[model samples]
Target: MTVFILVAGAFTGPHVWRDTAARLAEEGAEVRFAALTGLGGRPGGPGETIDLETHVEDVVAVIDAVTADSGGEIVLVGHDYGIHPVLGAADRRARSIARIVHLDAGMPRDGVPALAAVPDPRLRVEVAERAAGELPPPARDAWPRWGSTAGLSEAALDGLTALAAPQPLGTLLQPLRLTGAVAAVPVTGVLCTGNGPGVEMLQMMVEVGDPALRALADARVAFFELPTGHWPMLSCPAALAETLIEAASGGGRRLTAADASRPPAHLRPFLLDVPERARERAGNTDLYLPDGPGPHPAVVFVHGGPVPAGARPTPRDWPTLTGYARHVAGQGAVGVTLDHRLHALTDYEFAAGDVADAVERVRADPRVDADRVALWFFSGGGPIAADWLTGPPAWLRCLAANYPVLAPLPAWGLADTRFHPVRAVSRAGRLPIVLVRAERESAEIAATVEEFLTEAARHRADVEVIDVPDGRHGFETLDPTDGAREAVHRAVGAVLARLKG
Candidate 1:
C-alpha cells in the first residue's frame, strides 16, 4: 500500500485538493492533504504570523503522524509554493520517503526563498516596496501572475479567489535549508503544460547542456505531462489523478543527460574568423575600435542571459559577443560589449540600468561617435531593448535583434509589460529595426518573434527582417554555415547603413 501526502500551493489549502485526493483515495491509495497553516479558513496563528518553517512544521507533523500510524511507503506531492515545505520536510524525512513529486513547481536550492521563483520582475519590486510583514494574494483577475489559469472555469476561478490566503512575507522571504540526503530519493515531475514547460520542452532545456538543468537529466528524475493549467485539480482532476498514480508507480518519461565530455553549443568555436581587435576595458564594458578611428559610429552589442551570477567567461567574454564586436570593428565602426546584471529574469531592471550606463560610457569615449550609434540585442537579452524603442533618443540610429525573444514565454507567467518589446515597438514612430531571425529558432523564442512582427505590422513600424532558414537559436556558434555568417553580415550592414549620416 502507498501512503500519499499532498501539499497544496499558496493562496490555496488542502480544500483545493479535495477532488484529486478523493480520486487518489478511490484508486486504493491512502491520501492525506497537508493543511498549510493560515490557509483555507484555517485559523491564522498568534498575531497571524506564519513562515516557511511554520509550513514546514505543518507538513512535517502530517508526515510524522502518517509514518507513525502506517508502515506503507511515503510519497510526497508538492504543488507550486507547496514544494518548498515539501522539500523542507523531505530534507528531514529522506530516509522515510519513497518518491517525491514536484507538480509544476520550481526546483529550489538551499537558502533560496520562494520569492526567487516569482516570474515577474515588477511583482518582485512591488513586494519589496510594500515592506509589509505579510503579502496578500493577487486579486481574482490578477491570478495569471501565479500561473496560467487557462483551463479553469468561472466557478473554479471564483473559488480560488474566495479561498486565497494572505501569504506571510516570511514564507516567501525566508529560505529553505536542506541536507544532501534528499538526493537519494527518486523524483517525479508532473508538468502542467498550460502553466509551464511540458516534458518535451524540459528535455529541450536539458539538452542545452546547462549545468544547472543537468539535474533534470538525472536518472532519478521522471516526468509526466498533463495538458491543463496550473490548477490541475480544478481543471482536469481525472487526468491529473491518473498522472499522479502513474507517477507514484514510477511510469513516466525521462530526459537524456547531456554528454559531460562535450562542450555545449555556445562553447564551441565561433563561426567568424575575424582578426582580434585591440580592446579597451572600461566600466562594465569592452570597446573594440576600428582602425584610424575618429569618433567612429559605435554599435553596442548586448549579450543576453538570465545567466548564473557565477557563470565564468561572462557574456561580454563569450565568443558570439566578441565575434560580433570584432566583426563590427573590422567594418570601420566601434564595437562595444557590456556586462549587465541580468543573472535572473528579475534582474532585468538592473540589466537595463547597466546597459544604459554602458551606452553613456561608450558615447563619452573619444573613439565613439556620440551622435551616431545603434543598439543590438542577442537571445534572452532581447527584451531589455524595450528601453530605447518606446522613446528613441536623438543619437539612436537603429536597433537590431538577433534571434531574440521580444515577449515573455508562456511558462514565465509574467504580467509585467515593462520588458515586453512587442508592445513597445508601436511607440517608435519610424526607428529602424533590423531583426535577424533564425528559422530553426526555439519554439518559445520563435513564437514571440512571430508575435512581435505581427504587432510591428499593425503599427507600421519600420522593421527589416533577415531570415536564416537553417539556423538555430545560438546559430552564431551552434550553426556554422554560410547562411549564418551571411545573416550576421546583412544585419550588421543594415545597422551600419542606418548609422551612416
Candidate 2:
C-alpha cells in the first residue's frame, strides 16, 4: 500500500487538499493531510511564534504516527510555503520517506529564508520591513499578488480568500538548515507550466553550462509538467492527483546531463574566422582596438548568462564575445566586452551597474569615440536593454539584441519590472533598436521577443528586425550554415551604421 502525505502552502491548510487527497485515496493510496500550526483551522497562537519549526513539528507528528503503524516509508508532498516545513521534517526523518515531491515550488536552499520566495526583490524587502510577527493574507481581489490566478474561477478565488489564514512572519523569515541527508532521497518536481518555468526551460539552462543547475540532472530527480498555474491542487486537482501518483511511483521524465568532456557552446571556436586583434584589459572590461590613428566608435557586446559564479573563461573570455569584439574591431570600431555579476537572475541590477560602469571606463579611453557607441546584448543579457531604452543618451547610438530573453520566465523568480524590456520599450521613443530573431529559438525566449515587438509597435518605437530562420539560439557556434553567418554579418553592420551615423 502506498502512503502519501499532502502539505499545503502559506495562508492555507489541509482543507485545500480535500479534493486531491480524496482522489489519492480512491486510487488505493493512504492519504494524510498535514495540518500546519496557525493554518488549516489552527489558531495563530502568538506573534512570530508559529515559525518554520512549529510547522515542521506538525508534519513530523503525522509522519511518526503513520510509520509507527505501518513500519513503511511514504511519499511526502510539499507545495508553496508548505515545502519549507515539509523539508524541515523530511531532513529529520530522511529514512522514513520514500520520495519528496516539489509541487510548483522553488528549491529552497539551506540558510535562505522563505523571504526569498517573494519573487520580486524590492517588494520582498518592503514586506519584511512592514511585518511585525504575522502576515495577513491578501484581499480577495489581491490573491493574485501571491500566485497566478490563471485557471481559478471567481468562486474558487472567493473561497481561497475566505479560508486563508495569517501567515506567521517567522515562517518566511527563519532560515532553513539542512544536514545534507535529504540529497540521498529520491525527488520529483511537478512543474506548473502556466505559473513559471517548466522542465524544458531548466534543461535549456543546464545545457548552457550552469553548474549550479546541474543538480537537476541527478538520476534520482524526476519531473512532470502540469498545464495549470501555481495552485495546481485548487485549479486541477484531478490532474495534479494523477501526477502526484505517478511521481510517488518514481515515474517521470528524467534529464541527461550534457557530456562534461565537450566545451559549452560559448567556449567553442568562433563561426567566422576573423583575425585576432590584441586585447587590453581595464578592470572588468576588455578592449579590442582597430588599427587606427584616431579615436573610433565603440560597440560594447554584453554576453548573456546567469552563468555559474565560478565559470572560467568568463564572458569576457568566451569565444562568442571575443569573436564579436574582434569582428567589430576589424570593421574599424572598438569592440568592448565586460564581465558582470549576473551569476543569478536576481543579480540583474548588479550586472546592470557593471555594464554601466564598463561603458564609463570604455568611453573614457582615448582610443574610443565616447560620443558614438552601440550596445549589443546576447541570450539572457537581453533585458538589460531596458535601461538604455528609457531616455537613451546622446552618445548611446544603438541597442541590439541577438536571440535575447526580453522578459523574466515563470517560477524562476518575481517578474521584477527592473529588467522587462517589453514594458519599457514604449519609452525608447526614436532611439534605434535592432532585433536579431531566431526561428528555432526556445519557446520561452521567442515569446518574449514577440511580446517586445508587439509593445514596441503599439508605441511606435523605432525598431528593425533581422531574422535567422535557419538558426537556433547561440547560432554562432551551434549553427554553421550560411544563413547564420549572413544574419550575424547583417546585425553587426546595422549596429555599426547607427554608431557611425
Candidate 3:
C-alpha cells in the first residue's frame, strides 16, 4: 500500500488539492492534505518569525500524524513553492516516504535559495516584488489562471479563495538543507504544458526558459507532460489523477529515446520512480572509486544552483560535470562528484559552513591522495573551492575551475574573493592552477584571476588561464549542444595529462 501526501505551495491551501485528493480516495488510495505553516489557515501568532524551519516542521508534523499504519511509505505530492518544505520534510522523514512528486514546483536542494535559482530577469523581478509585498490573504480564486476551474463562476472561485490563507513570509525567507533526503528517495516532476491559460501562466512563470527545465531534460528522470496550465488538478483532473496513480502504482511506461526527442515530451525531464534499493543513506556523499587496483588521485566536481541530485533527470548523452568526471575516470584518476547541500537552491549560509563541509568531505576521501586532491568548481562552486584552497585542508595540490565566479563580489560572496585564487596560490602555499573561462563569460572573472596571478607571482604561484570559445556558465554538461562537449573533453584530457606526468 502507498500513502499519498499532497503539500500546498505559496498562496495556496489544501483546498487546491480537494478535487484530486477526492479522486485518489475514490481509488481507495490513502491521501492526506497539508497546509504549509503560516499559510492555508494555520497562522502563527503575531511576531512569529515563521522561518524556513517552521514551514518544514508543519509538513513533518502532518506526515507523522497521517502515517499511523507504518505499513507503507508516503508518496509526497508538492506544488509550486511547496516543494521546498516537502523536501525538508522528506529529509526528516526519509524512512517514511516512498517517493516525491514535484507538480510544477521548485525542486532545489542543498540549502540553495529559490530566489537565486530563478534566472529570468522579469520573473526574478516579479517574485522579488511579490516577496516584498505586505501580507495579503491568499484565496483560491485569487490564484488567477492557475487551474481549469479558473474561469468558473464567481461564487465557486470565491469559495476556493476563501479556503486559502495568507502565505508565510518565512517559506521564502529560509534556506533548505536536503542532501540526505534526496539521496534516499527518488523525485519526479509532473510538468504542466500549454493547453490553456492556466497552464500557460505556469509555463510562462516556471517552465519557460528555465535552467531547471534544461537541467531536468539533461537528466533522464520520469517526466509526464500535461499540456494544461498550472492547475491540471482542476483543468485536467482525470489525466492528472491518472498520472498520479500511475506513478504511485509504478505503472507508467518509460518513453523511448525517440519519443523523448519529440517536442513537449522530448524537452521534459524523465520522470523516474525511486528504486527501492536507494532507500537508505550509506553515505551522504557519492565517491566513485576507480576500478583499478592501486590508490588513485580523485577530483571532486561541486554543482552550482540549488537543485537536488534526483530532481533533474540527467541524460547520459548530456554534457555535464558528471560527463566530465566520466572523462576524468577514463583518464585513470578516480573521479569523486559530490552533490553539495547549498546547491539545492534553497540553502543560504550566514557563515561559510556549507563551503567548509564540502572541503572537509573531499579531503577526507582516502582515494583522493589528500596531499594531491584538487578542486574543479563551476559558478557558485568556485567561491566554496577558494575557501577550501585558501583556508582549511591546505594540502590541495592544484585547482582547475570553469566559468567560475571567482571575484569576491558581495552578491556571490565576500569582496576578498577576487584575491582568493591569488591568496591560495601566493600566500598559504604555492599551487598549480588552471582557470577555464568561457569566451562569452564576464570580463570581470578573467581580469580578477589575471590580477591575482600577477600579484601572486611575488609569492611564485603557478597559474594558467584557458578561455574556451562558445562556452557558457552551464554549457559544459549540456552535452550534444555544440562546442561544450568537445571543450570539456579536451579540458579533461589536459587534467589527466597533468596528473599523470
Candidate 4:
C-alpha cells in the first residue's frame, strides 16, 4: 500500500483532512496527517516566534516519522500555505518522496516567500494590516473574506471554522530556500476549478509571466483540474482522494528521453569530428536527419547555459533543444544539436569560440546544405553566437534566438565586452534575424532583447521580432503547458520559414 502524507494550509490542522484521510485509508493506503507547529494540536501558539523554517522542520519531522513507521515511499500533499513547508521537506528528502501534490496552493520559487507570491497588491496590504502591532494571526472568522468557500455545504463550513486556528505570520514572511533539488521530484498541481476567481487569477498570472506560476507549469508538474472550492477535502473529499491516488501512482513523472521506449527513427546521436584543438572543448552532437537527405537545409541548435565545470552530459540535460532538433528534422531539414564548452562568467570569449567551431562542424556535414544553414540559439548561448549574427558567413541563411540573453549581466561579473551581443549587433551585417522574446522574462533580459533589436534596426539589419504571449524564459524545457508548447512551435515555425525563404 502507498504511504501518504497530507499537510493542511494555514489556520487549519490535520482535522481539516479527516474526510480525505479516511477515504484514502479505506482504500488501504496509509495516511499521515501532518499538524504543523503553532497550529493544530502541536505545542506553541499564536504570537510565538515561528518562522517558515520552523514549519519546514515540522513537516520534515513528520515525513521522517512516517518513513520510519512505514518504510516505503511517500506521496506528500500540501494545500495553500502548506505547500511551502512541504516543498522544503521534499527538497531535503528528495529520494523519499514519490510525488508532491499541490491542491489549490501557492507555488513558491526559490527565495520567494508565500506573501510575495500573492499578485494582488490589496491582498498584500490587507495581510500587512492584519499582522501589524503584535503580529497577531488573522481572525479565523475572517477566512471567508480572504478566499472563496462558496459551494461548500453548511456542515463543511462549520467543520472548517471549528477546526481553524491562528496561523503564524512568520511562515508567510520567511522566504523559501531551494537549490533545484525539488526539480528531481515529480510534482502535480491540482487546480480547484470552482474556487471563485482563484483559478482565473492564476491563469492571468501565468499569462503575465509570473515566475512561480511559470515554474509550476514546468513539464515536471502535471496539472489536474477539480471542480471544487479551495477546501476540496471538505467539499469534495471523494474526488480529491481519487486525484491524490492518481498522483501517487506515477501520474506526475515528467517525460524524459529515457521514457521513450524506442529511439526516434529520424533522430540519431553522433560525435562531431572536432579538430584536435577543439576536441577537448567540444561535446557530442545529436543529429536529426530526415530520410532522402540530399543536401537539406540545416539548423545548428545552440543550447543555453554556462554549464558548470565537471558536469556530465545526460539525455535529460537539454530536453527542449533536443526536442526542437527532432521537430526540425521532421520538417525535412538537418537539425544538429551541439554541445560547446562553457566557461566561467569571465571566459565567455572562449565559449563563443567553441560555439563557432561547432557551427563550422555542422556546416561541413555531408547531409547538410552548406549554403542554407541557419542557427538557433537559446538563452546564454545567444551571446556566444552573437558574433556570428553580426558578421555571419555569406552562406549562413538565417538566425533565430529564443529568450536570448543578448547582454552580459554585469552584476555577475559579465560586463559589456566586445563579445556582448547587444554591443555588437550594431556592427553586424544585414543578416535576417528572428528574435523570439518571452513576454514574462526578467526585466533585465527583456531590456536586453529590446536594446538588441533597437540596435539591429539602427544598423539596418533585417530583424523580425516575435513576442511569445504569456511565455516564460526556458518555457521550452519546462512542463509542456499549452501556452509553452504553442510558443515553442510558433518560434520554430517562424525560424524555419525564414530559413526556407
Number of the top candidate by lDDT?
Answer: 2
In order, what lDDT does every prediction score?
0.84, 0.85, 0.57, 0.70
User: How much lDDT does candidate 3 score?
Assistant: 0.57
lDDT of 3 by residue, 283-401 (tens): 44445455566467767666543333453442211235445555566556656555545533224341146444655765665656655566677654565555655643545656777
Across 83-158, the per-residue lDDT of candidate 4 in tens digits comes to 9999998999888898899887766788988776443344566666665322344454544443556458987777
How many pairs of residues in model 1 come into backbone collision? 0
Candidate 3 least-lDDT 10 residues? 272-281
1 against 4, candidate with superior TM-score: 1
Model 1: per-residue Cα lDDT over 379-455, one tens digit each: 88898988889989989999999999798765674546588998899998889999999987765567679989999
On the 0 to 100 scale, the lDDT of residue 316 in model 4 is: 21
Error of 3 at 426 (Å): 60
Candidate 2 lDDT over 236-261, as tens digits, reads 99999899999988999987788769
Candidate scoring better on lDDT of 2 and 3: 2
| Model 2 error, position 121 (Å) | 2.6
Residue 153 C-alpha lDDT in model 2: 74
Which lDDT value does model 2 have at 293? 68
Candidate 1, poorest ten consecutive residues by summed lDDT: 201-210
Indicate whether candidate 2 or candidate 3 has the larger TM-score: 2
